[model samples]
Target: MQRTFKSKIGILTHILLLITIILLFYSMWIKSIVFLVIMLIINVLFVPSFIHTEYIFNNNMLYIKSGYLPVIKIKLDTISEIISHPKKNSLFTTNPTKRYALSSDQIILYCKDNRRIAISPYDKEGFIRETIKCNPDIKISE
Candidate 1:
């Protein structure tokens, strides 16, 4: 069974996208070649990514994909603990993982390898419930 979870772009990302679009059109109006090129790059890199983020939970594997690239993949069985809401900056602090989300109620995943990953899904409860259903041994932290 495959359960797909969608991510809502955070405020910061939304603002950046809006700014990039505004500049993209402004560059066209001004006919600035250099500015147009830079805006195009920003639009290509950030627009497609933040606009389309889908987390796919397939069988025992969880796939974090954004647009064309796969971000993170984790085996459901390897999840040691799951935190629905963690303290700000306290998550992934000193950990090797990267910031997966902005200022939102993110779900933190603590793996058996002592690494934690943060993620924000539109349906937090449903995501957690589906994950737990896939791996009954996985523990959830409040």
Candidate 2:
């Protein structure tokens, strides 16, 4: 069975992003209509990921998707541990690991090969449970 968990995005975050985009387009329009239109088109194309980011657990794989960003696939067997971070902080950090998170409340999946990826799912507990089902030996840390 395949399970999908939506990303946890706050209302304040959405409002801020929307306002920023609108302000940017408005400034662009004041300078050049063509540039404004092009930016608008690009933003429209990339907006879906912001509104509907999700994580999918299908069989032995975990898929992380955000906007027009490339999908990240992690095999269940390769995940060695899961660490949950339920705090408020900057979403885009200078951390070396790949992050598919919109909010600070996220889980870091530590893989056997030493690769780490962070993701934020709405149902943190359920996501962990589903992952454990696929790879029973995976460890969990708070």
Candidate 3:
């Protein structure tokens, strides 16, 4: 079975992003409307990716995507451990395929191949529970 969950996007984050975008666009218009229009279109297109995200945990694969970003497939077999707190974990950004999140609570996944990725799921506990089911060898730290 595949468990699907939404990303940890808070309302306050969205509101702040919207306000910043509006202010930037308004200010840019003073110089040139063309610049503002082009940048506005680009920025507006990315709003969905920041606001909408879904993660799917299947038998051995975890599929995740934020907005229009490419879907990343993570094999449970490659995961060595998971850390609950982000600060304690020195997250590595070397993974070719990784997720960038905007939530306060994040889980750091350490792969057996020495790669690390940070993930933010709305249901952090449930996500860990399901991940353990897939990879029994995976260890979790508080």
In order of appearance, the predictions have TM-scores of 0.87, 0.79, 0.80
Which should have the higher lDDT, number 2 or number 3?
Answer: 2
Q: Count backbone clashes in candidate 2.
A: 1
lDDT of each: 0.80, 0.79, 0.77
Worst 10 residues of 3 by lDDT: 88-97
Q: What's the CA error at residue 86 for candidate 1, in Å?
A: 1.4
Number of the candidate with higher lDDT, 1 or 3: 1
- Could you give candidate 3's per-residue lDDT for residues 1-142 as a string of tens digits? 9898777876766886787587667868687777677767767776777777778988789887777777878899998999887664355442535655556567888888777777778899898889988899998886
Give candidate 3's TM-score: 0.80
TM-score of 1: 0.87
Writing each residue's lDDT as its tens digit, candidate 2 over 20-130 gives 598667868699877677767766765676786899988789888888778889899999988876334533442544877666677888899877777878899999999
Q: Largest lDDT belongs to which candidate?
A: 1
Residue-level lDDT of model 1, residues 40-81, one tens digit each, is 988888777776777789878998877555578899999888
What candidate 1 gets wrong by more than 4 Å, as runs, is 91-97
Better of 1 and 3 by TM-score: 1
